[model samples]
Target chain A: MSAMGDSGYRSLVDPEGGIVDRSIFVDDQIFNDEQEAVFTRAWLFVAHETQIPNPGDFFVSRMGTESVIVSRDRESKIHVFLNSCRHRGMKVCRYDEGNTTSFTCPYHAWQYGSDGRLLGVPQNLTLYPDLDKSQWPLVEVPQMENYKGSIWATWDADAPPFLDYLGDAKLHLDLTLDGRDGSEGGSEIIAGVHKWIIPCNWKFPAENFLGDTYHNISHESVDLIGIGPSAAAGQKGRRDADIAEYQHVWAAFEGGHGVHSALRPAELGYQPTFRDHPAVEEYYRKCFESREKRLGDAARLVPFVGTLFPNTSYHGGQPRALCVWHPHGPTSTEVWRFFLVDADAPDEVKELLRKYYMRYSGPAGMTEQDDMENWNYATAGSMGPVARRHPFNYQQSMHASSWEGPVAGQVSTQISEQNPRRYYEAWAAYMDGQSWDQIYSLGQQARGNGR
Target chain B: MNQLPRTSAFFALQAEVADVLSTEAHLLDDRQYNEWLDFLAEDIVYFVPMQRNVEVGTHAERETTREGKDMHWFEDDKWTLTKRVEQILTGVHWAEEPYSRVTHLTTNTQIVTAEPSVDDATIVEARSRFIVYQNRVEYEEYYFVGKRTDTLRRVDTEIGWELVRRDVTLDQNVLLAKNLTVFL
Candidate 1:
């Protein structure tokens, strides 16, 4: 099929000679293909063991097209399984979450233990003369792994090992999981999960976190967390006209992942006290002061923002959180946010974390709701024929691309089309059947480095 | 149910409690935030513990009868509540856009107590069933019905009761609609 005619996959480049793909957000067939090819095959995040700490505790979560139960058995070990019953395909556990030793399928009296073991089959001999009770346990997910207390599972039997898939992302994950001190232990999802749905492709939000800094400037006024609208008009009055310096931003990693730290520096009005805060201020200082001795001069200079490949994004610093963008359909996505706080942090610190969580991402949170509304509204506009006919532009700062680093990297100005360009580059590679390793290798090749 | 007060005293206290409750509800529904703030005591405690189904039996049975969970939905003093109101008035508080239209009905008022030590005022405990239906623009309306158990003490003048504490026990675990933008 032609690029435009293709349902699941298409290549879109801007008029100014850049690739731009819109099929990922519009085609239902493509959505179906992804449900099986991407979501089911990958080791998707379910729930942290901390969420269900005690025995018989369970939390219901969506794994792409399927509903799976993540629970703690009597042994206090975490287990993940298809929530459906072995007999009639009825959902065994109905509540969103609860504690129960055995789940009785309401259709019949067949009961299953927390470990996905078939405990009872109503009347084993009477119901079916030769029924084998041992063969009818609840269907468990193919593989379940708990790495650093965050539970993840995969449905595909032939998928690569979890650690190999994680690659360099594991280091970033550890940095996130292990609290700033990395001494008294790590942070926990203290406030529980804040879940809500938005009407947009899952990747749209994922790419936003990946590197789209344009929205920060274009949608500044509408952004609930952004600087006041008057700040936009008074650009000349500002001391540092270079938006980057005013924003306290940083981005770079071994993988395609990047996050802007504009909200974390002192000059940027937003992060004036970022250096004063005890948790990350010292970590930030140590990295900056003794760059060579600590994290390496190059690494020390780059303050972390969010993750890149696979999935998941972390907002470091106080009132920290992890945002997981889960695909719901071609045009709908559900975002589950887990606010983090150091397990040993003071009660007052936890309270501050709670206030921040509610302010930014909670059900009544300011910025999150606005983000959702804009994404949803944008999706609606894309559905229009004429609007979509005009390829969505990413042409801004196209000429600004410059080759840099050890490799000939397509470096754009910090606030340039770098994110969207890199995103499409990765998307084309992924759709064209390149493994994540191959894609990251290509990125490194373009930058003249070999991994 | 058995510990209800004497009919006459109970009726009088019930009448006073209902009047005070209606006035408070009017102030809230009418968006008289400042006026409503005056009705609450300085050290008021508001609680809304999670509700669960329990079977009637002995104390032992009740002990393990699902130690119903606790949710501090609004575990705040006056300051926090004041800030919340102020935020609602701010231009950026989008959750309240088109505002949450509410009709708070407080009925079935029955007094259960009268303190003797307090000279002019009365320490009357009352129960009133309440239902608040909120309508959010372009979205579905939400309904919340629950029992409002309140402890009321006489204000300085002894004319009416001032709510000392309000324990609102909601009947459902899962919220039935989108966001909850209004106070229960």
Candidate 2:
């Protein structure tokens, strides 16, 4: 498909360019198009494997607007199926997560096995004698894959292979998903999902995490609360302006996957405060040692926050939160956040990690409070006719740096628009109705030419 | 359903507990955060667990206690609560910049248990339904309902009751508000 086709997706985002029209955030038509084009076709994160470990364990998750049951069958195989019952379309499973051998619809006593096979229907012999039970199973997700421990599913079966879609972004994703020692078990999602609604476009959070360390200024209040490093620098005043200069890296991967990372001093290590306790500190030291051996110097730094293409993002460091910006509409997003900790961490460390996660990233989190205010206002502002006409600027540090590091893809200083530009470039590809192959080739060409 | 029988002493204790709860609610509703801190015991553990929609057969997995569970919306101690108050008083915490106007409605206050008077503190266990109505901007209003189980300790006759512990279990699994800046 041509970029400048009838969809006008080309006009929505400049082809491989930085600027983006504001209408993309507020237009209903564009939102619907994204649901069909980007969300359905792209690999969307469902749940971590640890969430549904045992047979009959299940959790209800969303793929775009459609709800799906992510479960482990009696055979202990993972399955993702639509939550809707084939009998009448009511949600077969209503719970967030639980362990059950079968799901029975509340409306009618229609039962489905853990593997999503229609098992029983109340009064089947009386109500519908000739009903074909095999033909009435819950609709299954076309493609589902587990990378490391995180589970992802896509509605489009023809989408690129999961790891191939991840590409170089997997290196960054591994820092969180896969443990340092390459242990048999990776990370585990905390007990519950910290979910809340934000009155903003989903792209704002996605793009922000992808590469907008520039927004660090907005978190000055968080620093003042003695939570951020700038707070520790006290009397010298914050060296906020030069944060990007301090060993930061940006990686733009194929398929719009990108990450902006800040390499904390190697001596400081992963979670420095944990070092205060002898046992906890020793555990971290061993982990870091293994990580350094595996990933080299890159292991020393943290991927502060980065998007796994479209909507899923992982924010590591003090309070590691795995976030999914579930788009409700063009104007609003439902953010499903899960705190992740190394499955092998000590109980005390896990407790502290959970506390840190809640304190900094949950619905009442201080850092998120600041960001939501900006995004909420930004979304509301775009509703204005005059505001929608103008394009939001993405030209910051546009040509400042090129790919010149050990990282696999396009590399830039942390405070650059290169990641967002690349993100929208991929968005434009999907929106323009291009095939996955075409999108991959376009990204490769762009990266090759250093665009 | 195993509620303590109402007696003369029980009535008096209930009245006192109701008064203390009313004052606490008033302080929170008025945004008297610093003053509200005084009502908490020195080693208070205030927490709000995240409710989940677990299936019917899985009551064991669904039941969460303060010590057993890793996930909670608010797991705060006196120190953390003080810090939260300090953050709010800085006049810069963006979520509470304009300060949410809140009304904490406490009802159905039931005394679950009461221990005999002791030298250090008198222990009292109570439960109440809480509905917090919060208004931020002119157009935005949010309501959160939960049931609270509080362990109040009357430390000596002078200070009366201080909240040693509180467990708030919200009705909604997914919070609709932008932030849970207000105390429930």
Candidate 3:
């Protein structure tokens, strides 16, 4: 971790002092630099595989601020390409999502196949002779990887592979993507996408999700109202009491990914989560029993929330979903959330989860609506001259951390700001143009690999 | 097109339905959330679908997300709706603490269908357009314009009608507001 201080990017981010420059949220120059340094080079979440499972299906998504089309070709190969047409600058595909034989540019009718191959040029033989069609395919992302059901892409070809970048973060992310029965990649997104705009910097939501355990106090109204899974059963909090005595871990990886997960002790087994629905409780009880049998000691890890590096975030347990905070400018974010449910889940379970997700997430959500209010006003607060001079205090429980957490990475047992500190440290490295070798702090990797 | 003559009974029903809508909007505008709950049935199903940009041919099938099966801005019931009101009443819900100045405008009112005949209708299918103007704190403002199709039931109460089911179609494909704290 000391190598991060030697990289000459420590001015904006001082981990020792645990204070960060406010310009990263409000400065135009920092925002512009981040487009190339942070978003372009990082493994950005493009789309979920379930969004475009069939051949010829496509879904328009955003990498950073630019639009990209995530398409499954007729041959069933997934590809991500810039939405711009080669001949002219017009967007080749404007409709949000639909299956199509080709993306025909509305401007000049420059047609490109679902595979992003240049298919048609109006009067190619007479208007433009000797024009090589092979040279002009729609510009595709240099690298793309589908980890489990998630699709990630990077513009920089030299960037590390997706799994390598995940490092120790994979175990926590796996908890989010896996099924309740301890199966591999059984989660599938629900039918529609929830999209909204927030007037705030992109990092506000990203850093919030990057294991900000201290922000629970801000949700005082929601916690008082008690809208958890067992809220009707005298459970008065934001989540179920199944993990009351479980060891809560705030884990941060070398590559800037971080998660807040709980390790359930074997002594506290099969706590009922849903008081209103007996079927739901029974379903989960069976899942917990089989999970213990299948994964043995590993099944103890339960997911809460996590953010994967730049802008992708997830809520694994109660309100299961994957979300992306797309950078619109220095002070705006376009958020898209894909709610997830197990593919084999009973219709009743899916229905219950859907209703829970509505009240727990998105703009209408009781819990996250309060969060958006904070983000909106906080971004406005950062733009003032005097307010910008002072940095935010992030020194809570600064030195109280263990090198090898039971989960992975730098582990904090109590409420701590170490995750955000690590997140900003890696963010400064990206801003300073450091390579993968200099970026990843591999001291914790050895412990993560022991499993 | 053939036309049916507008009868005295039809005019009476139309006026009554429009009055119910007008009263509901006023309750919200006055910040009478607790009183507004009386206008909803015990088993009311409130849904606001997320509009999507689809191919021309798929408009009927894919323009809006399915109510019970897909994700949306809102797909909740009376219990959850009551919780929203309760959360706001706590006086600490930052999204609505100061309470944004909101005015809901309902127009283009029409009675599309009537069950048990128009003359003796106890249930009616109504359609209208809404424009909600919200200004928050000091400078934030948002305009939500959309279509609303509601199932209004004629109840034997002082208000005489209650919202049995409400399905709102917010015209924008992507919601332009940060949060949907106000009721639609």
DockQ of each: 0.14, 0.59, 0.85
Q: Summing lDDT over every window of 10 consecutive residues in candidate 1 chain A, give the lowest-scoring window.
A: A231-240
Best-to-worst DockQ order = 3, 2, 1
RMSD of 2: 3.4
* TM-score of predicted chain B, candidate 2: 0.91
Candidate 2 stretches with Cα past 4 Å from truth are: A1-7, A15-17, A121-132, A180-185, A228-246, A263-271, A275-278, A293-301, A447-450, B63-66, B117-121, B156-159
RMSD in order of candidates: 6.9, 3.4, 3.1
How would you encode candidate 1's per-residue C-alpha lDDT over A385-437 as one tens digit per residue? 66666666666665554454221234443565555555555544445445656
> lDDT tens string, model 2, A168-280?
88877776666645443478988778778888899998988896878777766666665432333342211222233347888887799889776656555444334334575
TM-score of each model, paired residue for residue? 0.73, 0.92, 0.96
Residue-level lDDT of model 1, residues B1-184, one tens digit each, is 5675366655665677788988888888998877776777777665554333222342233211121121233444554455456555555555565577888988888776567622233676778899988876565477878998888777774335566788786666433433445666
Error of 3 at B172 (Å): 1.0
Q: Is the docking of candidate 1 incorrect, acceptable, medium or high quality?
A: incorrect
lDDT per residue for candidate 3 within B21-115, as digits (tens), equals: 99999999999998898889999999998888898998888888998888888887888898899999999999998999999999888777777
Q: Determine which window of 10 residues in candidate 3 chain B has minimal summed lDDT.
A: B1-10
Ranking by lDDT: 3, 2, 1
Candidate 1 has an interface RMSD (Å) of: 6.4
Q: What lDDT score goes with residue A263 in model 2?
A: 66
